[model samples]
Target: MDIFTGPKLRDFKNSPPHLQFNKYVLTGYRPISTYRDCLQSLFYLHNEFGNIYTHGIPFICFLLVLPLSIPWAEIEWWIGVVHYLACLSPTICSVFYHLFMNHEGGAPIYDTLLCFDMFGVCLVNTLGALPIVHITLLCYPSSRLVATLAYLLLSGYGVHCAVSAQSNVHRLQSFAWQAIFRFFLFMLRLTGAGRGSPASLRLYLTMDTLALLGGLVNISRLPERFSPGRFDYWFNSHQIMHIMVVLSIVYLHWGTLEDLTWLKGYHCPGE
Candidate 1:
């Protein structure tokens, strides 16, 4: 078959059993494909098409645009690099996972890609907040050290749970501790007990809200659930979640930028 013309698509029931997680998506499944064939699927219309591009296009845009906006020379070396990686990690992993999910390697490959995709999410949750922690505790070095270590330990647990999760709910639950930790930090900022840009707290909150909503929508399978087969090609819950995740990352970037700018001019009462 010509790569451009693409292979004949299958229905959800006829697709590989592992890929049938969404029963509502009744059509437009790509058959088990080779590496080249999977790449070619990018050009054709199918159920996974929106999933691939929603994150794929953002991955390209973020890769090219994020660095230019980061103040690398003005900030701590690790902060700038870690934030950039955090911003890029989820989208790129998602792109690859959605793109190659139908590879001939089958279920095992799909599982591995799923884990990789989960790890990308874990990376953002882990790395994205390091700066927040650093700034929130700027006035207390000892507390900052302890909090940073504690968060990393909690994040390790979150990563393990996320990759091993059997359901979307479980995957969403895996991040609860991290979210709670962030909430505590946000509380400190809100109460003026911790340090950070006042504006950033709201952005971070919005980011988390969108991410949570995305997970809930994916698990609930809304819209598609309401009208099965209607969303087999576009605006399915997964694609909606992908777009939400991208927006969440954008808010993360905006919040981090606000904090970073605040960090440049602000200092502790004594130092």
Candidate 2:
């Protein structure tokens, strides 16, 4: 409850250089802090407070609440496991990255956290779609195996590019291959070459759309670009991106659940 009586906040000009990525966010920056001080900042009002809580609350909710909705016993065990991890990974890693980004360790710590955050995104991209691939190519075991392996290879490349990326645009670009491959899967579903819950394709499309939009908005730094300093503490491009990312995850969950339910009764042409 209101930890440390609100440490004095700084402006963009005074913030650590690493935290100055968004020049439009002209105020409400937290100073470089010790580990304990960073934790204490959680209770105080700062620009990052919105970023931390936006993903932090969802991480807690997903960790506790999503499992209850998952049919862990009904589906292929691995599908359930991957889906659970995919749903939880991004937000938890994001919470950590945002929460301690300004630690006294400075850029090295920040870079490590950024990589950790990218790894979480990588996990979701890699793990989340194993089920979709498994279900889509269910009728063709050989094709399913090849597609799954291909996607894994692509995701590995993406992870390398993302963690090593020097800018936000490059980080967003790193996931392009995986997204394109997913688009191919969606096309298969649309053409009836791949099979899933018919409803799922739409949800999956929406999921990707939201994610792409979020990345573009973040890269463009919109609204904030239009009015600097106005959204320093909330509703800025990054916060908006965070909200969109959460919604995209929800869509992914809904789509996967649809596919799983459809899987319960469907079979290959001869099996």
Candidate 3:
């Protein structure tokens, strides 16, 4: 019988207690349907908990491969090191956050853990821009001042975002917004705006601002929260937020490729 048909429901009700109990136990250990619920579910043993642990392996592998493919001078090895460290920061913090965040007795420790989680987000966001900024500045020496300042600002924001006493929902929203803003700013540069030029920098700042706003709107889940559980598995606000983040990263990488192409057309610093 089709699982969705009425007969299935009738059969399920009439099934023997032993079989029903076994099925219920198996299903009970499965993951929760929502993002927030998944975080909460981490404290207990479940099939999804292991899946989540395995999710970071690919990212870690990519980080390892990055250095092998690109020479240090071409992309600056130290910057890649910083970016790699930053990327891992958030993942590590998240593991700990989910593991122990539910202990109600240690309010102070929980608060500290939340701070670390925020720090991780900020680190990942700022670090994402480092390699791009470094290459662009190298390609266009005139923009060094502007690039440095932008880097400082981005790095500072990451630190602030990490340490701030904000709720997880708010932090996640902020991260999504920042990633989106970075995406548009990069688009402007890829179109031929001079590095660190006033117009380009203004566009970049505007992009970041827009991203912050977007993050807030997404995390709050305003319209959907009005009807809970309706968008649990699909078409929900968080999924939109994740899509935006992935898009932003793609845009950043594209902008970097454009910078590399531009550099290839010109002679290197001493040549």
Best by TM-score: 1
Local error of candidate 2 at residue 54 (angstroms): 0.7
Q: Give the C-alpha lDDT of model 3.
A: 0.48
Candidate 1 per-residue lDDT over residues 1-271, each given as its tens digit = 8867788999987889899999999999999999989999988888999999999999999999999999998899999999999999999999899999999999999999999999999999999999999999999999999999999999999999999999889999999999999999999999999999999999999999999999999999988999999999999999999999999999999999999999899879977
For candidate 2, give the lDDT of residue 195: 90
TM-score of 1: 0.99
Mind giving the per-residue lDDT tens digits that candidate 2 earns over 222-260? 889999999999999999999999998999999999998
Q: Residue 121 lDDT in model 2?
A: 89
Please, what is the whole-model Cα lDDT of each candidate in the order they appear? Answer: 0.94, 0.92, 0.48
- Please say which candidate is ahead in TM-score: 2 or 3: 2
Candidate whose lDDT is highest: 1
The TM-score ranking, best first, is 1, 2, 3
Where is model 1 more than 4 Å wrong at Cα? Answer: none
- What is the Å distance of residue 67 in model 2 from its true position? 1.0
- Residue 16 local lDDT, model 2: 84
Give per-model CA RMSD: 0.7, 1.2, 10.4
Which tens-of-lDDT digit does each residue in 51-94 have in candidate 3? 33432443464456544533346654576576556445555665
